[model samples]
Target: MSAEIKQAKCIAVLGTGSDVGKSVIATALCRIFSDRGYKVAPYKAQNMSNNSGVTPEGLEMGRAQIVQAEAARIAPHVDMNPVLLKPVTQIGSQVVLLGKVHKDLSAAQYHREKEKLWDTACGALDRLRAPNDVVVLEGAGSCAEVNLMARDIVNLKMAAYAKAPVILTADIDRGGVFAQIVGTLACLNKAEQDLIAGFVINRFRGDIALFKEGVEWIKKKTGKPVFGVLPWINHHIPNEDSVVIERPEAKTDPVKTPTVLVVRTPHISNFTDFDALFQVGGLAVDFVEHPIDLSAYKAIILPGSKSTRSDLFWLVKTGWASKIQAYVKNGGHVLGICGGYQMLGTKVRDPEGLEGPPGDTDGLGLLLLETVLKAPKTTTISRFEWDGIPGLGYEIHMGRTAGADRIALGKKSNDGLLRVKERNQQACTEFDGAVANSGRVMGTYMHGFFDSVPILKKWLSLLGLNELEPPEFCGPQGRDRQYDTLARHFEKYVDVAAIVKVTNID
Candidate 1:
């Protein structure tokens, strides 16, 4: 490595705009460097997404970093992502610092508090960089938003703070690759531009030779090396935002395989929980928002949400509530998870105005239970049993639910007859959600319910699809394989030697 390169130990993957594959590139680099026997760690000063997962220590961080951590063959820690902004409203978000809820702030309020948050972010970065040979830093959104640059703590500012060379990534699939690279550089001041070491063009299709002139243009225009032109990789990488769900591709016929539809709520959270189902061979999972005929699908899943009450309000307003009710009434299997579980209850009480206004909202009334939004959010990596089958999952929610009526229970208890047992290091007898007497509808607080192979098999059988074979790998193991596949694909296209030189790795 060059003498100047040896001074740097971290490399920041900044993007020209949001969803331009910064996370994907960072993850690839983490795995690529890790494969070279370097002690690597992934770092993100701040992440704004509802797609999050709890660590083994019960601490929470964005799922993207968690995937990156796994790619680096390391345990995920909250310090990797010091600040997590979960948007609960259009203008406001629930800020999480060091895996705990710091506060809820509006956009302007959050900017005003950037100094304190910046210190925390820097401290986290330092801790991550101290032990690892290389810390792959991922930036948020565009690095050159002039209006937000003064208060920005996640992009070029973070790169400067960490003394890391920046690798700008742009998605060619979005078109205007040249404009994105040149325009972003034009927006940056000279000092900021100096931090950039190179650029990577992502999601390119067709012939690489055709893009030779394009690459030369960027290099000539910006005086930065075009590290690589990554082809559009068709892989199952967990998404960091809900925007992908909004523009899903057209669905196909299930054709003897079981079909499942997930109610795509307005404020969906932890949607990656369904990734396991997507990998199964004989299952078709689709996200549906508008009212549609649910009779074709074997099961309908109500996914976790950041704002349960408001999403439930949207469900009712958009006519999905009545549609789901009719589907379930017609013997269609329905599974409610987390916020979805809360929405299935008789009422949801938010007296502290935690989620929204302090009041009660009418639920879908599918389950005879009531949920009360309370303090001390529950975050745990739980081992549980579903219908006598072993299951593993995590819980991240903001409320406690109980049976609404004792007489309605009949032979069942307040926890209902679904019979779920959760173990968190210590074996504790705790009940989660309820199952209807009809046995067609079930609800649970666990997010990764479908990850359990036995449980998934049983659920498929319940949906009348018993001929399909179980996937060889599911859950964590399956995800690890995906990371490796991603690394190999990028390794073939990306300039690993250049990246190593940039990181000062000898």
Candidate 2:
């Protein structure tokens, strides 16, 4: 609401801490404003995650922004998320600036370059705001980290730059709701505290009336409005980070449905690929960290990973490798995707040290293929088919795979697919992925492979779960519906009119 802020109005959602629902709140705001006839776009200065998606221009960014773009009914762009940090090791991360890999930098080295990166982030935000009616900026992690405040470009600094009003969000489910908000405000200086328009409490379970006194106490203590208390939603939305996997859900009876176990690796990436699988009736998807009895499940899935070699090493060291092999020998089916695909091959060579130290490692040897981790990464919106079943997916990988007697999953093309669109208007006709001669094992570079209805149906049938029916909506259509539902759920709890007023949007 400052004269310096021109063209688009901006409102930022900053969390008290990580996984406190900043992305979800920002996403709802995008859809709400879009529904109100405003052209909305989402911006996150820096995102640290390996769960990414490719844009129509064949650029890569965090998948959370892609979901936000869809909620706004617009095409996604790299400008929406300028800096992405993909942790490849305990000490270092692959820094992606403006949708491309800039370099691998350690924590200390990355901090030294913050000044330059901050400028880049600001430029991206300016570009995003230029053509939009409103830009919903999302802050990463805690907005009140005292030590990181000076170096922070995503929270208060970015908000101050945009002259955007901030709505501090906290998860009541995490407990200490009072302390969470009060302590956060206490950490900020007076000017920063004044920037906060109000507070939104998320993930409140149980009776709302029971918390009325608590809400009143917070309002009086902070001298700020409590916008609303959001109830925990049971629906599935793609998580911006993998931390959600640590918070376990209520156990479901495995006997009622055929289960698919996903080997939860240390560095899991793009695990959202299984979101579609979770929706299929009579099928349950579980992420398992320890080696479990695979006999109870219909099939096993090795999801994508940031450090393929390291995770593959984990599979062997943790006893999952032997268990998976035994399951395959018992005539069980298995599917490996991206880094997982690399692990299923005969050998994986990282001679150039793309993932780690220069060397070679033996794969699970399920497929007669070899993978070489080499230079420039491949990121594309792809179209393909599997056993004549049309499919749509995207490929994001850094290695070239080769094999003979490989059953082609699909030949990539510019057309003839259901969901994915042609990138850069170019036609491509390359074959991707492979299937074992035994037909029990398959591997693909494509993420979102199961998003295709026909492919999901066929795969289920192949796994002997023929009785289960595919959901009414699948892929993009289904995902869009979920976003709309999320928006509605959020609106029911939050004060939308007050939020609009706070943004000073006409």
Candidate 3:
């Protein structure tokens, strides 16, 4: 699309393992490049798994790319996430376009269709390269799976096609960070290996002084510079992968502090919906395994689930159904988003297994309506004004609910959906422990609703809590100050300047 294809510079970030902080590193790199005044874009050729977001153009992309784009302070682009596969079953998944699910196909079935997806990926990357000084590409999972490597469009093939240099990141905490990097290089074909510029060691939890010998061992083994040994940052960062976000055993605080239980279920996508809750002061958030008591919490929330029927089944099996109902019956507040919102209703129907074949599943009976899964999924940003709440939030969930005459969280536009209306609504509305119905309970499909001050305050008031202060916006000054804070945390162990130097404009 541009004459500068030959001149445009790019870099690919690949991980030695999943959940090794590759997305975190890429976002940090975006901030670094953006701070230097270079036009930068973040890209990921193909992203499998669930956890998607709708772009400004009304197209769908992975949520991780959106975070990286925010780091660059750019409007999210669809081409940034060329292919998204949201699994509907163990072997089958729904193929998505820029933001909507186009069709459902098995893994083997989808491979046959990848050529068309690859063409779209290339087109998106080409557009990203057209107007930027640098495009940082993030790879999915390990690049060493030889079997899947042939079909891989997100990692090596994407790097080759983009003509971008690659930097492999291996997790030192996994043990054998050296072997992971070396084994990866050994596995790749020579051309793929040649694309690598160097590697970074991520999530090192020990004394950096102790790793000097191992660092030397890696250098002598691969002859490539170990760019940085980054220590783990305990600071709050967005969890890009839903799987990691869903399980918080390690990150969860063990103290018997005031706890809010998140009911875990099958098809749980977008667990990041509760990220703010995780950091709420004077409160602890934990995922309750089955057979656990729900009566112990001051509040309970059911997050978005991919399969309403299956997750509802899980709720029954885990005995959380009766427990949740009992909690509400005893005057506790319950909140649900997306599929979780559906489960809070009267009933759910799937005639086709868009989640599964033909059945009507009973809801938790928390809300008054019913939800029916449709052939085409509903994915969009809902802007609404509810009972006086304001601010701008987005909705990217499927299925529809009925029977509730009014929205408790947000109002509807002509387009029809709930979104943030006021900035302080999240804080003011939920402060000092205020509950909507008081006797029953309340919830909405809006994810970032609590980010609003009023809404947050009102919700907290219902539970007898108070907000210390409003959350800082995720803008340039805010992110800069936050990232600087993060950098300081890593200053003692990580090679901060070296990371910036690796991504610096030439």
Candidate 4:
């Protein structure tokens, strides 16, 4: 909306393959530009992932955009991510258009509506570009997937649309970095190939001097410059994708390491809620799909699910429900967040069939609440308190939930978990989440609760794990520090001058 930033240029960070660090690269550039005193924003026309976040306006968007906006030191908006596809089934996804739920569309039906979606994407891009000096664009998956190329509006096609210069990123640690870079160029026609300005080699392991030949070979093969070879980063960034949960896991021991278990549901969303645990030392987190012996872990956490009912059935079918119950019966701690919070109650009713079939599904019965799926999803950046300690988090869910006794009145009781002071940037007094009389079983709809030091410390104290202490650099300030570190890392290897040259901004 500022006249000063109307002259924004696009710089696309496309990938040679999925998980090639496109999002991370874009995030770094956004910070680098912002530190230089330019107003920068991030844009991704469409994103397909279960991971997402709510904007300050209480609208839904991809979590990656939210992270980038934080790096740029601005409030997140829907235009930064116009279309978000949260896959609910193998063939279908819940389409969120311009920050509101559009509809559930199958793959075939979504493609049929591509023409309209393309218009919406372009409009969002124009609106985003109107208010910044530079808008860093991030591409999804491979930019040169020939089969999906014709229908793909995310990668090369989008770059061509904005006349944005592309910097293709490849994961050298995955092997075949040369093939990934050269083969991508080979697949592109002249016009499409010309859009790409250069390359950024990501996750390069071992000595950089050893890979000089590899860089030169890529440059000679494609007649393009190798912008940088980023060494393997020991530093942590947010989740690249949910596929990371599938990595091999080690055994948990409440006695040895104070480990915790996160039930890995098939439709898990917003697993980034626990990303902080990895940063602060002394604690370990693991995602487990199958029912495991729960006695070894200090606590069990149920994360958010895109389909609450579907994942509820999975909990029962997979015997995880019983396993969790047994863990709670033994006085071990258990916490559920978001959809996982919905699953902790007695029953989940969906008479409108908002999430698939219309029916009632039994919950894990750990809490005294019940949930009914309803219209106009609750998406808010919330400010709340626990035991007089202030905390910040977001609420993104559907329907209403309350104590079974209070269900008739349709009101959440004062006995609920946190005291909410504000939602969606508006002030109001209300109670959120539920807790059992035993206090061992706790459930809340709030995501990122652990980001608050008081809430995290309180949870640890409640679990009687006095030995575990959260690190000081684990909050927003810590995150900002990490962004600076990331910018410094990229600046060391990547050619920022060359990037600015390509953007025509210098």
- Which predicted model would earn the best lDDT? 4
TM-score-superior candidate, 2 or 4: 4
- Candidate 4 has a TM-score of 0.97
Instruction: lDDT for model 4, please.
Output: 0.88
- Model 1 worst lDDT window (10 residues): 406-415
**104-144 per-residue lDDT for model 2 (tens digits):** 99999999999999999999999888899999999999999
Candidate 3, 57-139: lDDT as tens digits: 66678888887887787988787887888877889887876666678889888889889888888888888887898899999
Clash counts for the predictions, in order: 0, 0, 45, 0
Error of 2 at 442 (Å): 0.4
TM per candidate comes to 0.94, 0.94, 0.87, 0.97
User: What does the lDDT come to for candidate 2?
Assistant: 0.87
lDDT of each: 0.86, 0.87, 0.71, 0.88
Candidate 4 deviant stretches above 4 angstroms: 1-6, 248-255
Model 1 C-alpha lDDT per residue in residues 171-274, reported as the tens digit of each score: 99999999999999999889999999999999999998999999998989989999999998877778786454876532746445577888888898898888
Better of 1 and 3 by TM-score: 1
RMSD of candidate 4 to true structure, Å: 2.1
TM-score of 1: 0.94
lDDT of 4 by residue, 256-293 (tens): 78788898898999988987776656888888887767
Model 4 lDDT at residue 482: 84
- Clashes (candidate 1): 0
